[model samples]
Target chain A: MRGPDAHGRFGPFGGRYVPETLMNALIDLEQAFRQCIDDQSFQEDLHTLLEEYAGRPTSLHEASRLSDALGGARIWLKREDLLHTGAHKINNALGQGLLARRMGKRAIIAETGAGQHGVASATVAALLGLTCHVYMGEEDMRRQQLNVFRMQLLGAHVVPVTSGTRTLKDAGNEALRQWVAQVEHTAYMLGSAVGPHPYPMIVRAFQRIIGKETRQQFLARCNTLPDVLVACVGGGSNAIGFFDAFVDDASVQLIGVEAAGSGLDTDAHAATVSKGTPGVFQGSLSLVLQDRHGQVLPAHSISAGLDYPGIGPEHAYLHHINRAQYVAVTDDEAMHAVEVLARHEGIIAALETAHAVAYVLKCAPRMPRDAHIVLCVSGRGDKDVSTMMAYKEAHA
Target chain B: MNALHTTFAALRKQGTVACIPFVTVGDPDLEVTRALLPALAAAGAHVIELGVPYSDPLADGPVIQRATARALAHGTTIGDVLQLAQDTRIDGLDVPLVLFSYINPIMQYGINALIADAARSGISGLIVPDLPYEEAQDVRATARDHGIALIPLVAPTSHARIASIVAHADGFVYCVSSLGVTGERASFASEGFALIETVASLTDVPVCVGFGISAPEHVAQFSRCCDGIIVGSALVRTIEQHSEALLDRSRRVQATRDVAHFLRTLFSQSSGGAQ
Candidate 1:
């Protein structure tokens, strides 16, 4: 309902906090985006690609059996898992890919934590015939090897980042560093609704299709907006995408679930909003996992995608303004929910999405039977098979 | 005048280009940093840049990143780095100390508090590599109030941005010669030389170039282009090769000698006044 002001600020949050070298580049991007974003031809071309190539308008299904098992709120699943590249990451990747071609950049660069974003970027790069390079943490690359191979097959040079925490944060840092040097000829295809100004706004605009579609589809199916919108928050793109259209609906509640890797009581967690302080990081002002001296702490999660130490600035703004309520779900809780969804709903959600399912399991029982909840299934759990196997092996 | 201004003014009068060396504080340990600062200063570092180790140094390359990791591994905080600078000052090291960091640590420390503590710690100025001048007004004002110069960075920039940076530049303007992040490179771009020229033409303050000047020849070549030269990753890489053990006092001593010798070599080869 409400967008960031002219400064790309959602209140005191988003701004282009970067090196002087990248300031002009960011300005150029902002100007380019501002000009072409509303142009009919640009939107048409982007829409055509989204529909023809990337598979837009993913289905909305009612999880009746899972709803029956939960025995309370009716559950509607917005299947972003069906998007090309098996995750909603392609939405932004494709959008940025088109923008990159429009800007006449020769190559595309991106940072990946879950590997989904990298895969999506690579997929788009291959489709559009742009050379792509992706920076992924060594740990994430090892765990998400399937996606890595997929990226390699798609002709992207995946650079393994071994610096910092060796996760999303480090990959992001490496990408930004690479972008600083190659700004004239490369487009940094940022994956999430995080980072500096314009990026958060641009990503949200591309992803807002989820909310826009959900509104139309749900109205046709259920005849009304759901009582609640629930989505996992790892840099908060899917949640922002899901929440943006319904943000003005006072009756609709937006719930963002953070990944609690072990538990919030322990050090191993990515529950940034729950445990972090406000600081400037990764080109934006957001709630970050940092120590007393503001050195960003490494975040952990079972899902590589949800292991980022920082959330998007708009999510922080929303949390600050009480527009949304944030909750933390432990890895164990999420895994159990993943199993429950598999057994009851015949759906295996990505561990990142399982966090929301886990939260719904906890909250649904308390809600009225008539109350409706829509869980944004941001991605399918195909990539998490190895993690599942490891969990199985360890527990066995 | 402040220590930074005084140092630059005196260096100008001496017709000598400043040899500024950067090292991550608490890189090996606080003791190593303490001894290293003075050694670098004594070896002809006109101004010493002490890096505040950040987990995510976006502008930094592998060399500095490894140094920061080593520093953080030993639980080195900004407070500890400030303590080291203060201790070195107490031990009669008179080099103008510039605390170089990303903005997060200073923001966490509270900008006003950091400026006050920096001044008390005998720190002369600050250089946040990622902090552009547009978002730096408040910190610059407070730093000025605290007698600490908030040094503005001039990357390889366009003419308009260069004008904006020079018009408001305090202390000395740090001109990054390389197109990329901090590291030693084999060669320089013609644009880098042009950037130094552009900055020098517009600014009264000393213009120092950093981001990839390693060898003594590089120092001599760059010294001819600007008022000063900052050696970062190459200098850190030198100590890293000798003192891998971080806590080994003898190894640290050897590394400190190597750095001092490195700076001495660079300065001895430097011919004269800024080009």
Candidate 2:
């Protein structure tokens, strides 16, 4: 009930629906993950790397100015943006990179949307001296050119995917294809808590450091648990990591904010939980934005990371069972949150993270003045400076 | 016996390997696909695999992906392809038809309803590349109830899994020729032959080699061991090459003939006489 069952189903939302060729590999991966997690040396190495290399125990800072500006709940920010790759994605990337190395794979392949994961994977590959290939959508490469260059600069070959709306979904398909072609020597370093079995569980486990540290830090600093926990849900990596530790606590409210590109009323939103149906997508059964005939619909968002048609299956399961609540925030609202965070807290939060902040901005003022809310600022928004400037010019 | 079982049984009795040709329905539109089915049968296809164009086809390479894009561009769906099957059956087509699809479209169509309709539409078998043996229980059970063969695929990596995967395999065991998506490979390693031998050792069902089988030599090579050979991307590539001709009213017949001619040459090289 906390994680997936033995067969990897979070109820009916997650299962291994992949080609026969990948089945044995998945089995091997699951076994390796189980072994590695239990091994003390593996955990020690991971802990050392997190502390020394990638910077662990990311600070949970209470934003007094931002909280006072909101005038209701006192807001805390989980500072995932301060990690080595400027995002929480490094947690899973490093974990998977180590797993791949332990599996005797010399090369790693990954799919990226906004390119934060690509950069994280590339950085890990560079540090570990493994060959890396990052499959990115052509459109994403264009929009996130800075991160694209960062991946390339890290010695990762960036392959542009031009199929299927020229976005993250197509990048995923291309990565799977290439992984199939060279699965013998390569390991797929999946970016998020999506994909087939063991992946959601694995990513959540790797990223649980976030929630673990946050819980300890918040309780130590405030002498009590936060009343509310919020994180943006793009494949639900950071959000899942942040929520897993508190899933059993009935007193804490967990909210996942989805990207509403224009609005949920329009056809152009990436709000999967807001407007999606159960379908198999990218190796897992989850809530997907697809046509009536099951063709995946193109998702749109100012933030490339959130522009995905499918949500992570665990999040779908959580939503289905009413363990968590999911809400949507529009691009404009997210952009406004970006500006507010920058002005009030000197934090340039990623657009994906801004969705969470935007939702808190709307709801915090209505909560009790003593209520506490922890928001996951999942990534830095330096990559979005250009997009932000362009948006401002257009609006002006 | 079902059409798939009957076709494979007859092929084994005749001491010849079956030739299975795959095409994406609604590529260059549905009418050409309709014409290609019977044409492929005439060109000695023992069974035909109809690929449903999906939005995301992870098991396919660029060639079939392009075919899918073309097919989906025209708004092709599982319903439309099944309708095509019904129409072709009405046109007196006798070759066994296997619907090769990714699992999403079928899940969207509602599994029970799709299987019943597929049975009614003369679809002989189902091949969902994404549905491995473990997750295929409900789909397999439904297809079994409807008397449709849910063909299973085995790869070199399938190793000890081959037996359990083929435990309830109906129709033929689809043996992936290599460890990759569907496309043409310059040469195949002996791993394919070993995998096929292992699969044959496990199941009584006929084993067919597919994935990366492009030329006649590949078919001839695989025909020596397997009960059949499946040609997907190669034949779909042929359709792609003739897409301009297929879309033209005046050149459509010639293009269809050319495709049949290509299949004939490919089949002609196969020493197996069953097809």
Candidate 3:
């Protein structure tokens, strides 16, 4: 059946590998989450927030021009970019924010790389009137100053993490450290399907709205499920959410795209599923880009959102069981897809989302003309315009 | 009994509190780590916890975190640390060696190989902060097979679960002095002592309190309730302060002596100062 049994294991991955100080808190969180799942008021509150606040049921649009350009399968876009926060991150943020309020936590803390999750968490904290602290790597803060400022404008204190690579991995370490120190009154609003037990399960549950809506919309429009689903994998939150509803469907091929910065032969990349090995990272056993000494290596990517060394333990499980296929696309390919999408569909996609689009551009042409493929556009590209321009200037 | 248990037993018999000092191996370099071990032993450390530098040390605060970074920057690995331990013992450092590490490095080294090597190197115990009670059964069993004590850490948050957490615990129970990562703190949590007391009540093994313990006052306070006191971040910070002197070939001996002096003064206030 669906994994992560009582001990939070999927085969051999996913467990609470945190310090003893957070064990009781995790157990209580798990209990509270289980109760919230069955509580009618909690469900209604979450649904109402998702619908009235975050804007649910994001449209599934037919990308006929892009489809014809690829010249094989019809391409459909799950428009999570249309969400209020300009990303699918709002769904989990609102859900977890409600949970934190229910748990009577006075404050919320989170870590971010590309800063979409930080902004979304700050938005929720502002909506719920909770004090929020967002830990961001110094480098990410430099790269995503706009999102960082957006979080500050939403009334969240942004703490810069300067330890170990000064990126998402270090940001996560710093956040967890803060959470441990402040577990009494704080709820760590983990933004992805990584970390310890119950988090992967919790985030997946909150984000499953993507797959749920896509299923109903696809059936209503096409009268059949799409042949394949594609989404980029950082910590695999959006991909896991997009794949949840179709996991049991034997014919629905699940494809997760990982960022291969430069190339896999080089040291710079975030292709955890493709190049990583099983190891404990950020409180869970997962596919991690680490040295032979088991020290986590820094991951590089054009997309700050996808520059992470660890994959979600659930994604690692899915890969292990052969239920899903993972592929890597270089920064150049993703950049090319960004241009192609903007030209063909008049849509600007985040660099992270372009990884999925890059994969679709490659595989859609190989499939039958009648076959349909759905790609998750996880975020808008407003946050990446400056980065793109800089890259262009450097390359030119 | 193993070296850890025997050491604790002897300290219990003598009515003296066990003083454990932690140092990150190869912080400046392995030569300094080798020189510091005997100094710590001479400074009245009953057992020394040698920290293996890891890229991601989540359970550590800024002090030890920086220490690990420095150690890793010098290219320190688990193998180097274990080799250092063996080398120091060959030079006649009699204190039991307890390895403090994250779980990933141990996994990379291979669990069976690690236990075997640790046993061969005369390592008495292991304290993997990330390997909590829930997922430690297999590792506990493996360490047991090799006569290595896989020390378990219990925190103030581990209420009602303390018994099961330390049921078959071997060397000692590491009681975290507060609800945070390792660093010196002005004061510990209100429930910290009660948690230690609760663990002492449940386990036959000696209970040692660590985390946020730096000052002699913290050592004296925890010594009243627990069998031993472990100072990590504070000690690591001391080594860091003297890292330049330690790295200097001519000044290394003085640096080691200074670190030992710091540990000595901290533990000198332990258990009514009978020592």
Each model's DockQ score: 0.75, 0.90, 0.89
Model 1 misplaced stretches (Cα beyond 4 Å): B244-247, B250-254, B273-275
lDDT of 3 by residue, A311-349 (tens): 999999999999999999999999999999999999999
lDDT of 1 at B93: 95
lDDT of 1 by residue, A1-396 (tens): 375887778888887678888888887888888877888888998899889887889999999998888899999999999988898998888888888889999899999998999999999999899999999999999889999999999999999998877889999999999998887899999999999878999899889999999999999998888999999999999999999999989889999999999999999999989998899899988899999988898899999999999999999999999989999999899998999999988888999999999999999988989999999999999999999989988888
Q: Worst ten-residue run, lDDT, model 2 chain A? A: A176-185
For each candidate, report what fraction of the true interface contacts it reproduces.
0.70, 0.91, 0.87
Report clashes for each candidate as comma-separated counts.
Answer: 0, 0, 0
**lDDT (Cα, 0-100) at B159 in candidate 3:** 83
What is residue A178's positional error in candidate 1, in angstroms? 1.1
Taking all chains together, the TM-score of candidate 3 against the true structure is 0.99
Name the candidate, 1 or 3, with the larger lDDT value.
Answer: 3
Whichever of 2 and 3 has more DockQ, that candidate is 2
Please write out the lDDT profile of model 2 over residues B188-248, one tens digit for every residue. 9999999999999888999999998888788889889989999888899999999999889
* Model 3 C-alpha lDDT per residue in residues B125-203, reported as the tens digit of each score: 9999999888988789889999999999888878887888899688999988888888999887668899888898888
Task: For model 1, state the Cα shift of residue A215 in Å.
Answer: 1.0
